[model samples]
Target chain A: MRARDVVITGLGTAVAGAGGPETLLRGPVAGGDDPVTRLRGPGLRYKDRATRLALCAARDALADAGLPEALDAPEGTEGGGGPLVDGLRFGVVVSTNWGNVDTVCETSATIHRAGYTATSPMLLPNTASNVTASWVAITHGLRGANVTLCNGPTSGLDAVHWARTLIAAGRLDHALVIGVEPVNEPVRRLVGTGGPGLFDGAVSLVAEAAPAAAARGARPLARVGPYARRADPDAAVAAVRADEPAAPARWYVPEGRPAGGDTGPAGLPAHDLSLRWGRSSGALGVLQCVAGTAELARTGQAAALASAGGEGDDGAAALLLLAATAAGAGA
Target chain B: MNVLVTGMGAVSSVGGDARATFAALAQGRSGLAELRGFDRSRFRARHAYEIDDRPAPGTDVPLRATGWLLRAVAEALADAGLAGDLTGVPVLVGTTLRELRSVELNWCEGAPFDAARLHFGTALRERFGADRTYTVANACSASLYALGLGTDLLETGEADTVVVAGVDTITESTYGLLDRVYREAPESVRPFDRGRRGMLQGDGAAAVVLRRGPGAPAGARAYATVRGVGLNCDAYHPSAPDSGSIGRVMREAHRRAGIKPADVDLVLLHGTGTPLNDEAEARALGEVFAGVPRPPRMTAVKSMIGHTAGASGLHSLITAVQALHSGRVPPTLGLDEPIDEVAGFRLAREPVTERGMSLAQVDSFGFGGLNAVAVVEKVS
Candidate 1:
């Protein structure tokens, strides 16, 4: 594949696990305990649980991106107000695996009580599938085009595909694509009986336009790899089981080896940097969306994105977001 | 008129199936009457298209508004003469209300009722046997949004012959809210009228099959070639669209379709008849079409059918397709006094002759400013 210049510029996150990206890199949030829970905020009343998670992530992401603080009403209100929001070319594309459970429950209740008209007018707008993206725009004063992709659990990566395609097509100068899922009673019950999709949170990444990232003297973080990858089930099981026989004290290899990975010099295409997700697989796939950018923010470039193994058919997802071959690990 | 409309569906108060529902709509019959879906005994004036008397399993769900959607989808596919496995085709559905009716079942009823499971995508996939199902929920404009996305998917080679369906039955929750607002001002919904009170709740679904490349049904032609679609968020309000942005979507659609405002023959307006909505729409239409001599002859079908929420745009598009097919544009259903805002627009009160051969445009704005506008051209 030809060299493609891509850099992460903005970040936002709202995780059920207590830690933000800073702590997230150090260790996994799930100590294999009960489900993690995010805080309930004033944002809940105006929007549903799913939306609350999205906003929380967007708040952190924008701040991490080093963009100006956001004003509730307007930017430049230095009267103890937040910094300026990001640019207009910054488009928004978010993915959600299960956004409707809460709203569905709400609408269902209205139907049961006084018929369908029993629904709240205030709540109707936010329940729509695209409301998450639209609300993001309204909250942050983003007027750019928005796209919300709902693809089962592949929502996060689907959002990446949409944003990356748009960027490659020169649609937006810079784009903020996010993946968010919120925990609610109905959804919790549904997932609890499920074989997968155990957790919920939001992760956003910035795909800076060529000029914008370069103008800021920002180095290219990682290659968006040719094809996005989802982990193989059998391989995942092996990784988890092999952990038992590993050295008791030594930390596992941060670099995940490809199945039948070549036995070569420690110079594999993605043979660098440490990758850590508190929870392995399943819900951890979501972290790929965040980790790719987080690594970029810290190491200026992470060699590869990996989903942890060992968890049940908890489908792990990873993309090789490696840096350009300037350090000599390329074709 | 080459654009072929092979299938159709609807779920409204009068009748859930397409044939029965469309007949009622053509006759200008109101679906709003009594409230049975929910315990609306407390409201001042209880009026809604409460879908009671569930249609038979294959017929229509009697007590459920979504039941109409179920029946409608069947009739629509049947009309198109497509019933066997639809495993290969993609499904693009626009819905403002989905198991939203289920919301009440969980919160108000304690836990989710068994009935809610029927509307889930997994169930729909099994029922319809489609390979893909992209459920779009975009408030009132959902149907149009689904259609818009379908057009893009087709253009991008994502799928061929995508089935676009949009439906929503006025749930007890939604109607109760409407009753409260309508109580503030009691009046019939009169689009483009000076005394517009607010929007009314209507239940229904509309389905359109879009085929790509040269492989349409034999001898069947497209009723309208979906040239371009413009979708945007107002970012101005939760339940309303931004006039300025709406104006841009109109421009962008035309630009993408390689046409100009002067080329439009008809403007299918999403006239919910609510004062705020009508005013905002009028202002947006005026701003967008100010350059044209007279705005495209604006006709609203919702005036006759009520606000169909998610399926409104698809219904409007179907009406446009029929108009293009018959060489006549239908008149507005209910318009008493013209709103001062729609000054430059021609509110068609009676069926009019088709003026241009080029194309027609339809607008559908959902709650939260989720807007969708599509350019439909006469099949060559």
Candidate 2:
């Protein structure tokens, strides 16, 4: 069977200091209720900050996609009386670099300083790296393929590609692709607070087959385009642009790595999200996609490209996002 | 678009390489011993399945798991007959406590460690000149998830050859958590046993070189054909395995493989030996193979190697593939009285040699109810 075209139907954000996706453009704003508090229902006691932020973003994305029944359902009901979507066919792919590091570091410290007796059994489940993704699945009743990508800088884009792959393989019809990073004491100790600070929350996108979205009457924000991963910035850009009829109207480059010279398309306007939102690590790629969707909605642009590569990164990844109106035009 | 396992490598408590590990399993050699990597006086369970021949720590690779991964990758590449520069081949690593031990050392012992080593991409790039690497942390089911991703890459024509690996080392944090969770740790892992205690931690790394069958070199050795992989989340509990989800995933695997449940010759059970896990798995198996004239015989390598955390899936896969080739099913050591749920099922208590085994299924379920099942067929 031929691969199906994947479209982004909904977007959500639980970013610190930013009220909404539109607020992301104006740069970081301070002071707001804790993102964790944005989550509803039980199962919050033992969850780490990353998982809570992911739940918030996931809830928003599902609601934005017009699938609020997935959230409104009673606890344990996969999807409560939803005619539009089936929770069983929905999956989740989460990308995070230092996910739950705070829990891990603290738990280890507790075991080290006060011995094993001092540790709490409730907090032990949070130490697993995939805990955040699992919580997102459990909370929302996404019973399909659940995967967590902890790959370095490009993980967010990788998560997007993985969702597409699953859809094309008929594993799931829809997926919540989330990119989250929590900046806390453990993160500060690990990377140090020097460069482009740390991103404190999460961003998510609801990706599904174009036909599925159309059947559900959901508006497509953008259609996923070609993706490429290469060892260097130039090759990655060139490969993603190889089959495109025209260069992307705008580009979203990796954090701390500005677009210039060979790193980006020559004349296209480039935006570095980290400059305003801090270094999101694994979340940068998805954040860039969200920004691209916003640009498409704002200016009616034809296409946009989001590229990721950073210091100590093994390779670079580039993903193209075509405007929804141009979805029929083959790349 | 056939995904073939062209090469295999493993380093575990039982042995340092895939061949040796399989031999040890067949010989009923147990790798369990007193846990010596860290101070075990405080914990009630002092025993674990740990590798004895650990390489000396290097400044470049501070994390012990990274060394095991590199060694496993080397063996896999060599086994696949692909030597020298692996420039464009993508590497996918699955792990649970990736470099967390290093973090523990740094935080607790004031050891100098670079946080960049937390992910395996940098180390892989430095060692193999790999252009792209993905580190998946799907808990214990991580490696099978990576395998599924690699299969997608192959089937989608993304990459001709992909290296999928899973590696983990015993860390104080995980050990302490399990030690605390289990009221009394069994001296040995006894999967599917009536008196099974809880699971013990293990340290290991395993890798497989997957290639598009048509593109593989003529006469290249193919261990098994990856027919299909089924992945799902129970979305139920944080630490408990849901039998319904397990049964569903197994059926999904069979569906994707275009085969029936009865086609599977041998089943490599997740069989963590934890009361909840073994019971749930047995129930799932019973439901999945309810109508089959002859149910597939099952074995749990963890009964011998202990639970290797994220690496357990790949360890089980490598063992299953080896069993497919050798026709010798490894024993699930320390299982004397079988669990009631597995009453009629043939649980390999001793090494059994049977010819003409063509298909095998491997099951791996992890914390947070992450489940991954793979169906592999013997390649002629």
Best lDDT goes to which candidate? 2
Tell me how far the alpha carbon of residue B354 in candidate 2 is from the true structure, in angstroms, after superposition: 1.2
lDDT of 1 by residue, B245-308 (tens): 7887788778777898888888888888877778888898887777887557778777666788
Model 2 TM-score on a 0 to 1 scale: 0.96
What DockQ does candidate 2 score? 0.71
Model 2, runs deviating above 4 Å: A1-3, A69-83, A258-265, A328-331, B52-61, B214-216
Give per-residue CA lDDT, model 2, range B1-380, as digits (tens). 78999999999988889999999998788889987676666667879998755444222224889989998899998999887467889788989888887877776676787876788888888898887788898888899988888898888788899999999987777788887788787788999888889999888999999999754677568878999999888988888889999999999889989999889899999999999999999999999899899888789999889899888999999999988888899999988999899988978788999889999999999988988999999886
Clashes of each: 59, 0
TM of each candidate vs. truth: 0.76, 0.96
Q: Write down the DockQ of candidate 1.
A: 0.24
TM-score of chain A in every predicted structure: 0.67, 0.92
Candidate 1 lDDT for residue B362: 91
